[model samples]
Target: MKLPRMVYNQPEVVQPVRTDVLIMSPWLAPIVWDGTYNLGILNAQYRQRKFRVGITIFAIKKYTVFVKKFIESAEKYFMVGQKVTYYIFTDRASDIPVMNLAEGRSIAVLKVPSYPRWQDVSMRRMEMIRDSSHTRFSHEVDYLVCVDVDMTFNDEVGVEILSNLFGTLHPGMFGLPRDSYTYERNPQSEAYIPADEGDFYYAGGFFGGNTEEVYKLTNFCHKAMMVDKEKNIEAVWHDESYLNRYFLYHKPTKILSPEYLWDDNFGIPAFLKRRRFLAVPKNHDEIRNRR
Candidate 1:
């Protein structure tokens, strides 16, 4: 069954309460941090050093158009003044469009073999990232962000999102109970999560952390996927299932609100006053099934 669309409208002004400012998850962990950050302070602290931020995205074949849009939007709204390098992994690097970049921002194309199945493309991302970290990424950047190509930065996604480890709350599952979350439930699979335990179902499409931590995460997920493959068992959501299991045992240092990965197709929720990034609507069947 499809979930209801989260809706939002302006609220009436009221006297502020100290308790009202605190953002907590159902498990009572400090998961969401919307108003708690000061962007000016964060930007001032990180921009001075020009922190080397690496963004990794895959745009194999037909998805190149989405990458083009992502690059244009990211330059305008994502960490605008920071030192950022987009490590674009694609089969056809020549398809990447040329765009003007701000000072301290640039792009590098990494050629990856094309996969026939979308599931293979999704699962292989973890392995490729882990391999790339050791060979190329480790020597190039301070932090690494793995994100889907079909998304665009809608607002300032600045230093506030950075940490030792970070995960974005899935827009569709953020409000649901743990049991209702679409986690891999089979015990036989490496990505299983019991019904009684979970903090949040993080979106696999957007996540990042310190260079070392992200490398470890990619390595861990790759190993887990290999184990599942040996048993001929694929999790319900492919790599996403493994990611949920990883975050369960190894909690993220920070949890980004749904604002970071809202779907443009859904109406804004009242709690999400500002949307930092938006998933561009696309024909999922065409993109995933064409092969």
Candidate 2:
């Protein structure tokens, strides 16, 4: 199929789009940033394909409060002209606010069980998504994006982000050396990574790929978590740690710059020219039931 006939900026072979930052990983995966690619061109290609995307998020217990704003913001800024299904996994599906979705967009809430501790809830998300991949997503969507429910879209997160496999750089860990990354160090845990070895600290909050690839990612992550549990050892950041381990070996086909996952605390560094998805500040003590 041909992309929509349209006129956009002409490409320049000698002119690199992003010179201030690393636009490509050592392994050659594209590191997506503000000036890296033309969104208009990418959108036309995906629009012609009429591909469907399933964005998965878990809002168990009190986290359900964030669902409304996230959904409303996504409707406005995410893949505006494409088909999307917001696959919301929430304990309080009834509490999710009702809003009129755009053309070719819809919401599907799967009532999930609530856990007492927030960590357990976070860890279980892998299994939940892993289970849904075959049961719901494979049949309905071409791509599956998994994100943390506590965040909201701050700008356009469109088809330019879709790929066979992709992961976002953790805003807090951006530009930090690999040794400084907070990887799970325990030799026994399946998520372990030696201090000297690591590529990038990927944010589990926003990661995905085509349904087939995402299914393998979730399956491996969920299984690793189970193995750790059997040994009575939990990875430092639970699912996030396991996710980092996954990427350490299976490099993402596309790596999203910190722009895709930012926190206000970072104060918008020069490289982070555009902020897309941002963290919604919350009192960890109150929301996560921390001591």
Candidate 3:
């Protein structure tokens, strides 16, 4: 007699999904891309940390001397190590320095199609990051930083801020207060701010979080843009405001400090910024060494 049909069960195999570490940057200003100088400090900070670090620059071909210098510096100083990778996301990746930075390890070059419009331009910034964040390489990153290329790492302010936030890794969001908004036009924008109110005005320059939160935030930002389109609001600089609104309304996690973020020249008191991210203090020798 034929034996009863045997039942076969497939073995349960677990496939670990991977993630990539990305530092998203708009690099709009040419002065901010000096890779070697920035990397010297970034490396010092990250060398002791336990995460892979990589940078993403949008529209690399338009890079000026400052931008090119930074890109080249990043290529030379931040070349791929076991844990780091540098990515250049542009419409044309053919001649861009994707390989020079990859060194021996795998370097990624992602070409995202372009668009027009100020808000759309900012959206492109997020798109480059989102694309990289969701790619196969994304799984390698425990966390990701959305940064502005113009900002330099005078010290490892990036890592210091991240360390503080990671230590408290609450289910919340963080950002720099907007440079005081004193609008000469648009009564609506002016009336929007009360003179005495000191609510945090999220600056879009830098922010980061677990890959999951970042994905969610970017997705929200994209959808919000669609809403703005429908409503015919044309202010392109409102991305940061949009984020500030979302975080305030949602009340995820609040990491508020200026140390983590300072505008090109807006010098908020060091103590205020230091509450969240500390500036590297000058040692006695260095202080005395200063002429």
TM per candidate: 0.89, 0.97, 0.55
Q: What residue runs in model 3 are displaced by over 4 Å at the alpha carbon? A: 1-50, 64-67, 71-82, 98-107, 163-198, 250-260, 267-291
Write down the worst ten-residue block by lDDT for model 2: 1-10
- lDDT for each residue of candidate 2 in 1-291, tens digit (9 for 90 to 100): 444568977898999988999999999999999988998888766666667999998877778888989998898888887899999998888888888998899999999898888889999999999999989899999999999888889899998898999999998998899989999999999999999899999998999999999999999999999999999999999999999999999999999998899989879787778899999999967877732
lDDT of 3 by residue, 47-159 (tens): 66577555555543333112344454444433235355545565556655433435433445666665544346555575556656776435866566565443334323333
Best candidate according to TM-score: 2
Output the TM-score of candidate 3.
0.55
Candidate 3 worst ten-residue window by lDDT: 27-36
What lDDT score is found at residue 67 in candidate 1? 83
Candidates 2 and 3 compared by TM-score, better number: 2
The ten-residue window of minimal lDDT in model 1 covers 15-24
Deviation in Å, model 2, residue 180 alpha carbon: 0.5
- Model 3 CA lDDT for position 24: 25
Q: How many backbone clashes does candidate 2 have?
A: 0
Q: Higher lDDT: candidate 2 or 3? A: 2
Clash pairs (backbone) in predicted model 1: none
Each model's lDDT comes to: 0.84, 0.90, 0.44
**What's model 3's lDDT at 82?**
34
- In angstroms, give how far residue 259 of model 1 lies from its true place: 0.4
Looking at candidate 2, what is the lDDT of residue 97?
Answer: 84
